[model samples]
Target: MSKHWKKLPWIIAGILVLIGLLNPPLLPWILLILVSAAYWFLPRRGLIGPVTLPADDAFLPSQQVQWWYWTGHLFTDDGRRFGFEVVFFSFDAFVIMRDQLVQAAITDVNGQRFEFEEFLRLHLPKRVKDGFDLSSGAGNQVTAVGGDGHDRLHAQIGNYTLDLKLDSTQQPALHYGGDAHPYRFGGYTYYYSRPKMATTGTLTIDGQTFQVTGNSWFDRQYGELFQAIRQGWQWFAIELEDNRQIMLFDFKGNDSSVEKSGSITDANGLTTTLAAHEFEVTVTGEWTSPNTGCTYPSGWEIVVKGEKFTVEPLVKDQELRANHDLWIGPVYWEGACGVGGAVAGQAYVELNGYCKCLAAKLP
Candidate 1:
């Protein structure tokens, strides 16, 4: 694991891009898929030196494609409960164009789904203040105050508008990495999460509005998006009733070998980094989408650190087609889930990469 060897993928990609100048159509695409496989199969051997992290509010260099992600559970005043996710991705480095996207989805307990996504390529400016403050300078916006642990989420599209405030209750952040340095998969991200938070807001659908309040989870991942991850990933963010939280992500690959990483944040906010071999995830049920005929896992039995849990979706039809083909492509399953077995809790489950062999998020 030398630094020189780690630079090989970019070198190859740059060479392909240069060659693509003459062979426009074919080589560029070949390069795209090649770079993607690098992230999918490449073996990451930790880091050279420890990188201090949980750097909440910390950002990557503007040149790298990066994003801020948040997700949570909500309970409406009338007793309707649902799950939601808000994600921002700046794809400047990947496309050679100043492209950015904001995507949000809500999945209700009764199997109903609503999705909203905004992609802006030519616009004013993507502004950041006090570290985490983000302004899209458009009708759709998300802003996070660095110290307040407060985030304002809003969007206006067609006849629907959503506005919510998230107040994080977990502190110091959950840093997923080595003893001192942050762990980065695909070699470009410094990742962390506020596993438990309080959320309140108003969501307007058509002409009606609903007031909601509940618990949530916030994940902040920033850095190189074009680092290349070939197959998509299956992820889970689970919150137990005992003030404990767990986040697990496994990058799916073709050979049936998946790269696993996760962390458990206890009531005191201390995090325990999980080794890949320390857990096992088994798919217990499958559902085939009539739209694409792509089958996705519907039930899971996860054994982590010797504890077992069963996860089942609150609704079977909770799928979202953000259709972000220019960057991360494919239709994915993201919805609220119920957790049983060793723990009784609520969770958000995501199933991606099931639609095709070559789909990924650059970082």
Candidate 2:
């Protein structure tokens, strides 16, 4: 039990003793009310516990914050290419209500266009044993019903419909936090990733269907992280041609300090944690969003283990501007990118906290 919890029982005991001395007849009723309240308020064992290797894939609704994220690069048979992103988020607000959100986007690389959609609702669909089936509106859904490596994703926005199946090609990469203890950025975070997944499916644009195949990255994180995301973060998931997959995170605190952490998984499913000194990242360019007036890093030159990679967004403007009624216009950048230099590959980068307005709205 936490230090706060350790003292709670003592305080409650004192209250009961005082009530018994003052009014013996009412003590039993008061004790019954307290017991009932504890049963309803406290989280159960499995819902809040230490994260182990091969972390559980089920949705943790009791957690303060959690998300399932996917990003990939797809190719068409006729020489066209595209990039896609789909993410589901679940969070509890002030211990009062639960909120669910889904965000989907597609980058038409050949068409030089980027389109996205999002929906926020009060409740989420029930999840089954270690799996989830979530849908917000018509033609937007993400389901992984079997808890197996095979998963299906479907989303449609504008004139594009992205329907893909992802199968894990390697074992799950348990992050350093999961290797031993949970990561502590804003709070205790249990994080894991399925770095390399074989992707195959169809993408429809303007009623023209095309068969596509590619690779994808899956990320799952849940914790008491309500304050962690508000500060800022730069996350990258890269898959190189040599079958080496990497996941990197740079979390920015309120005092302008950056904490760096990463993990590299080889072709044989062996993962090695990367310390802060093992890698470096430099900003190569910047782009200002015309819609939200937020200036974001446009390009990056990241180096790890003496190997350098240049990453730039497939399209210059892949920013998502969210204007939901429940939120105060949170704006951020998450997009598909191309990698070059020591080894060629594809990547997805997420940049958050670029807009100061979000912080200003927070109490």
Q: Number of clashes in every candidate structure?
A: 3, 0
Candidate 1 Cα errors over 4 Å, as ranges: 1-59, 122-127, 133-137, 141-148, 157-160, 178-186, 225-228, 254-258, 323-330, 357-363
lDDT (10s digit) by residue, model 1, range 1-363: 565885677697777778788788877587778878866764332332333443335444443545677778888788887777776666554334655566666765643665545454442123444346555455535444443466777755445566888777767454555333322434455566767778888877688998989887777665443533444678989888888888888777655444677888888888888788888889999998665666899999999889999999887876655454455454677778999988789998878767762422322
**CA displacement after TM-score superposition, residue 150 of candidate 2 (Å):** 1.1
Question: lDDT tens digits, residues 278-327, model 2?
Answer: 99888899998776667889899999999999999989989877747577
Which regions in candidate 2 have their CA more than 4 angstroms from the true location? 1-55, 137-146, 177-185, 253-257, 358-363
Alpha-carbon TM-score of each model against the true structure: 0.74, 0.83
> Can you give the lDDT of residue 314 in candidate 2?
88
True-vs-predicted CA distance for residue 161, candidate 1, Å: 3.2
Clashing pairs in 1: 51-181, 225-362, 225-363
Best prediction by lDDT: 2
Q: Per-model C-alpha lDDT, please?
A: 0.67, 0.78
Model 2: worst 10 consecutive residues (lDDT sum): 139-148
